[model samples]
Target: MTQLTTIVISNVKAADETDLCISIQNMRLLRILSIKVTNEEETLQMDALSSPPPNLQKLLLTRKLEKVPQWFCSLQSLTYLYLHWSRLEEDLLPHIAALPHLGRLKLTNAYVGKQLRFGTGFLKLTVLWICNFPQLDEIIIEKEVMPNLKSLWIDSCMELKIVPMGIEYLQNLQQLDLTSASRELKNRIRNVDILKVQHIPKRYIWK
Candidate 1:
């Protein structure tokens, strides 16, 4: 208990008692961690959230996860990460860019939507939420490497066909949510040049 903050391990917590996850990894301030290991039929190997979260800011891993556990690349005081239908990928983005005060990152279907293979990027991601990844193939926003990405939400991927083409090199991108695109992939969306874009939400509003 290095001044432990908060930890609630009870989705009936039982990672097969692997030493109780190494005794909460000797809790070091442990900012706030909520895990609910449901029906763990043996696929949950966090390797200890990839060994970071020492003063873990806020991490909520809920349901359905099969892999992506290599101790999350040494979490350096992880800011906030919420994973839903976890089967995580995108190599976990160098363990979330080495968590230099990570802002907020959320994944519903969990895939990183494949792209932004930032090999040391995410200069402290702002807020990114990727939902229902049907195998993302677009939504690429990077301003010389995530210089504090503002906000981006791509909903219901459905094999997303065109959006991630460098994404205007995001310069503190404001907001973008494809709104579960499907209208022929929003009639070939490829307009780039968005910095503080606020719309793109009310999906397919009659194209």
Candidate 2:
């Protein structure tokens, strides 16, 4: 039997209702695992899968999970993460920022919150994207966080009325991409917030 390094389950009906906590610790070569359900009513309890493979680098969850599995924090080699419509209530940024080598992160309608804050210690991060989070009105970025970040994208956040606070601290940032933002927010960026991100080399704004 050929050893499988990547496993992806997408659009599987009732995938979330199934108890799929299989242990993959023996799959030492596994690097990517993605599970996406077709029905929003179903949920997957990934906590059943304890002790992930050491080489796991990318994890994508498209189901309606409440929170990220604690076991994920142990995957030090993980670099890219994408969560779509996970409906997480708690802020996962703090735990995510602790990832030693994480580089890119994308969230689409994953959070059920009004704000998202980024603290310190994202040394290797270079790209970030957040989209379709309706309740998210504010984003706070503390200084020294994501020092190596170069590109950022925010889209379809209708409630966000202004640019993220502390964006100026991303000294290495080169691009800021915005789409489907409120008109007022766009106006502020062009007028009131221009100086805040004037240093960035590229700006892409789409109405």
Candidate 3:
């Protein structure tokens, strides 16, 4: 319905896929949409759904997604995004940075990339949280990316050896949070790399 502003669908079965597709396309005023399929092998074909409304602000997709749907980039008004276990087989940072208004992002075992890079733009992003990504070994942040980013959280990435490089340049950064990281990583940050983010207003680390 045109007046519908929020829709959340979970445990979607194979037979109900068609109906969900139709319902999404008709929700012209939708501002929030969250979908999680119970079957890990089945992907919700987001590309087949109609474009979200210009005012839509929050999107969460959990389950097995091969890649982000292109329409997600067109949601210029999106402010919050969470993708968990999405099965993204490519670098998703570039796609996410295109959201002009995005302020918060959380990714839990969502990306398969060994190296996650953020190049130049996420004008409004303030907080980023990532967890449980076993393959992630490096995070690269180029100069001037996410200019307004204020907080960063990392957890349970056993392969990551250190905090992302170039983090010192985030002038607005206020907090750095680390949890469940490998002991070696904790020691590395505490003993050797503390200077990199020492200027940050707050830091929380739990080994």
Whole-model Cα lDDT of every candidate shown, in order: 0.64, 0.84, 0.84
Model 1 scores a TM of 0.35
Can you write out model 1's per-residue Cα lDDT over 164-192, one digit (the tens) per residue? 65555665566666776765556565333
Give the C-alpha miss distance for residue 52 in model 3, angstroms: 1.6
Question: Tens-digit lDDT track for model 2 on 1-207?
Answer: 126789887665544332444535556788898888777877656665677778889989886876777776787999999998888887778777788989999999888899998977778999999999999999999999999999999999999998899999998999999999988789888999999999899999998
lDDT of 3 by residue, 114-187 (tens): 88888878889999998889999898888888889999999889899877888878889998898888787788
TM-scores for all candidates: the values are 0.35, 0.93, 0.94
Q: Per-residue error at 126 for model 2, in Å? A: 0.4
> Which residue ranges in model 1 land beyond 4 Å of their true spot?
1-18, 25-54, 57-77, 82-102, 110-125, 133-149, 155-180, 184-207
Residue 8 in model 3: shift from native, Å? 1.0
Clashes of each: 10, 2, 0
Q: Where in model 3 is the C-alpha error above 4 Å?
A: 13-19
Q: What C-alpha lDDT, on a 0 to 100 scale, does residue 193 get in candidate 1?
A: 26
